[model samples]
Target: MIGVLTSSMAIVSAGGLLFALGEPFIYQVTVMPFIALAIGVDDVYVMLGAWQDTRRTLAPEKRMALALEEAG
Candidate 1:
């Protein structure tokens, strides 16, 4: 959730900066959000699935690290 929100904000900020600089986008601006959304949702699912597969006996931090590694 946090990652998705942060990425969305970063993309928006970059787009705004490009507009300010009068730089043209190669793709349509409207399509970017949908593409980002699809990618974010896919990533979230991958992370969640990885977390679920991690060992329950491990420490929380360790489990998270394992999940991230598996997800990656």
Candidate 2:
């Protein structure tokens, strides 16, 4: 969570810098992909964090049971 929060703040700062640099709007459009890529990874990081927390909370053998129970 700490790393995720720091990474997200860093990403926001970098994106803000890119927007503030006055690059051509058209050319700057290309940067959206990189920012999006970073955000995508950030999402994965959050998901893995949740997974780790869940795994730590429950026994490995209980995970499937928990998952199935949650699905219902």
Candidate 1: segments with Cα more than 4 A from true spot: 1-4, 25-27
lDDT by residue for model 1 over 1-72, one digit each (tens)?
Answer: 765786698778878999999997676577887788678878889999999999999999999999999999
lDDT of 2 by residue, 1-72 (tens): 554565667767776786799655566565765666677677666555555545656777676565544433
For residue 64, model 1's alpha carbon misses the true position, in angstroms, by 0.9
List the candidates' TM-scores in order: 0.78, 0.42
User: Over 4 Å off in model 2, which ranges?
Assistant: 1-25, 55-72
lDDT of each: 0.86, 0.62
RMSD of 2: 8.8
Clashing residue pair totals per candidate (backbone < 3 A): 0, 0
